[model samples]
Target: MSSDELTGASEKKGFSTRKAFIFAAIGSAVGLGNIWRFPYVAYEGGGGAFVIPYLVALLFAGIPLLFLDYAMGHRYRGSAPLAFRRVSRYGEWFGWWQVLITVVIGIYYPAIIAWAIRYTGFSIDKAWGDDPEKFLFGSFLQAAKTPGPTFDVVPGVLVPMIIVWTITLGVLAMGVQGGIGRTAVIFIPVLVIAFGALVVVALTLPGATTGLNALFTPEWGALGDPSVWVSAFGQIFFSLSVGFGIMITYASYVGRKTDLTGSGSVVAFSNSGFELFAGIGVFAVLGFLATNTGQPVGEVVADGIGLAFVAFPAILNEAPAGVLLGLLFFGSLVVAGLTSLISVVEVGISAIRDKTGVGRVAGTMILGLPMAVVSCVLLGTTGGVFVLDTMDNFINSFGILFVAALSMLALAWVWKRLPGLAEHVNAHSSIKLLGWWRWLVALVVPAVLLVMLVLELRKNLAEPYEGYPAELLGVFGWGIVIAIPFLAMLLSLLPWQRGVDLEDPGSDQLDHADRTDEGSLR
Candidate 1:
């Protein structure tokens, strides 16, 4: 490890504060996935029973693994590769795959963000009444949500996507304090307050009781299904911001005295809190509305486009108050997506910055421009979005599992086992694990990951899905997933006999020398 990192500090100039950390992590964790993805997954997973697996996964898998990432980052105090090197030289090779995944995700995710932005903006003027879906085909998502002769490709989608990307790049290029930290400080709390308000309103709706009961009640049968456990584990891992190298890279920028374990706890819980809260908000509003309309909960739950794009606009048409709430909710989603997207871009940008010594502005554009073009194309074709969808599945199923497994192995076995590993983790922890937690990490987490990997691989082999067409695109999609680790291994072949030299050796001292007491990120 470099002298700066071993000393447990970050470079002061672009370092993050506890509050900044909280907002940034929240910003990273709470995304359309929270508002858009989780509700659907929860309903599909087992309704109220889903919470059981989710919480269990959080206890056994998410929190400990998060601390592992933070510890690795703080322990190494550099980019992802440098952090992995602290564990072992071979491990640094594993880090590159993570970097690659982040790069690909950064390239594709803007399309989703662009879509969300378009939907949000669409709600602003041309009010589509209670059944917005009726008008949507003739209006918004003209190609996908409702397709017909009205589908004429235009610069509308691409223009807004570019604007969003440009704005995000500008903030990132401004450096952490002026850019990332500042935006988080302002936006994260606003998101919490706004979403919290939405939840309160959602609960007051007509069928809220059914929604709340559905969300909170436990169905014991779900506990028996292996898929439930797998879903829960996936949610925790994805929501807690692990496996993306985002947390690792972000933690590298935090100060030494920050209490990584404690901070990690706050981040993990804060992430889960938003998800649980958002689920309640979505299901409650939909449930109440469904009851009034006498629609089945299953149909209501399947109202994917309806809830966000259709029913939400309908709610606003009936009550302008809902329009305001809709704005806040979608606004929060936009912020969350941006935060995660920024982290994704930064991973690749950091790699380029380290190797080429390029300016952040130049690096960002170099990484972003091509990705923006790709996102535009994805938005253009019926099959275009397939690459992104396949990429998401490939990474979530294989890439994340591979990294999580490797990370556990490195920490639990290769790094001299858990007793000492636990000490390193609990070094500055206010909530230290006893002994059982160590055994769990060494045994349980890895086993769970292996089972998940096996199931995913089997599912792919047995139920190979062909989304859209264009075999070349399918190949590109799967290729990126496999390429991540494959390239990482190739990069690891380089000799690093001189220990590891960080891109910022002076970072730790700079971080330590500027220490100040601050509250946790939550």
Candidate 2:
């Protein structure tokens, strides 16, 4: 809560306008998960009826957490670690935990994007041929025999991966407004148009109605299942990218006068709308696949890598004007994935610049080169798929949720900074954050996160994740998830540069709110 942040002043770069910030935020939110993860999670939860809990989760947990991030970043006017560091001495650990989580995500996120890049080209010839599954694992990936580290490079993956890193780092080096903001302005609309066209084409296919029915046909009884509710909440949390440092870092780039609450609402709704749109397109295609193959929709549907690389490619081969369908779908993935990856990688670059007071290029060089090397070395190898799959699962389940809950507790009950944060947001927000908003952010969201964590722990402990070997799970999945926090703590011990102001702002009214019976910011 520096006076500069209070006055809407910035020492670092920022978005030129509110529209850019909104576009940038939406770009981060609408990602690969929207395309592959949400539809399956929705169908599994309760088909169309899953929208009930999903919307509830969005309103109650997702957006609340989103605003919480916004307040912290916009109020403190720094990267995640610097922002939390401004809150109090003990709070920086949570910030670093988020930063480290982004690091892990950045390491592997681009490989998926690269896959989409190559596949977009592969669509032209139906290069995967009849056996898409085998081609994915055995041919394109050259997947290793076992899930462990391997230096053996796969040219198909490596080349595209290098290109992905180049494109991402290039954009990041151009500064916030010129690179991130402008790219979102340019690309988000393109993504919408391309994916929208794909949906239209998908609807025109035979059995599209059957697919729509299978997708939208709600199981009324699923609402009674606690697991379905958990699925809905999980989908909302992950889909919004709320808990992680992404929103926090992104929000810091926004102008202080911006209507953060309004922007947040816009980003949240746009993300969910895209997800639902994606579900429609995916199911329509799946229905066509079922009709063509003489199988049920259930058998044709999949999630994660299987949905994009295997099922879609198989579906593409049999459809009329198959090349256009493949291009639209896979090309959409590339667009969606690039925007998300840039956001992910930007978290690290911004953190570096804030700590060292480096130029954008210097920060990009420091973070980008090493990140790209590791991304190419580890993720571009034959064993990359195993690492990507395991890391993506554990990190999303544990890394993000774990830190999010802790952050809420630390801000609400520990430091007692929620009032000040709320005040900061309310000052500029078009939609006021009231007492209920505080309660939702401080208590309800944390409780939901804890429940999700417990359920995830129970399920993972019951069986090896995806039935991968124990050692692989231990090293890649559990090991990485567990290691991030401890590593974050170690990083927090390092000193900030002279340029970083660690001082707290004047009187945050730490106890005045409770004493005066002020439960919310006006």
Winner by TM-score: 2
For model 2, what is the C-alpha lDDT against the true structure? Answer: 0.85
Off by over 4 Å in 1: 1-11, 125-139, 142-153, 303-307, 310-322, 356-359, 380-383, 415-421, 470-473, 491-522
Error of 2 at 330 (Å): 0.6
| lDDT, each prediction | 0.68, 0.85
lDDT of 2 by residue, 1-522 (tens): 444543332413467788888898899999999999999998888898888999899999889888998888777766788778888887788888898888889999999999999999999999999999999999899999988668999999999999999999999888788899899999999999999999999999999988899889988899999999898889889888887788988877765567889999999999999999999999999999999989989999899889999999999988996899899999999999999988988888777766666777888889899989988999999999999989888999999999999989988998898888888888778999989998997889899899999999999999898789988899989999888889888878888876445755423421111100011110
TM-score (C-alpha, index-matched) for candidate 1: 0.85
Write out the backbone clash pairs for model 1. 130-314, 207-288
Candidate 1 lDDT, 1-522, residue by residue in tens? 454553332344445567787677767777667787787778777878887788889999888777767766665555576567655666777777788778777766776677567766665763565557776544444455322112235465567678778877887777655677788788778878888888888788777778667666667787898888887887787777786687877776676667777878888888888888888888777767667767766665643344666666665554435666667666766777788887777776655544344666776777777766666666544433445566677777888887878777776777754564456556667878677677767788888888899998887766554533345334655566667777888865665423325432333343432211110110
Candidate 1 lDDT at 336 equals 76
lDDT of 1 at 106: 74
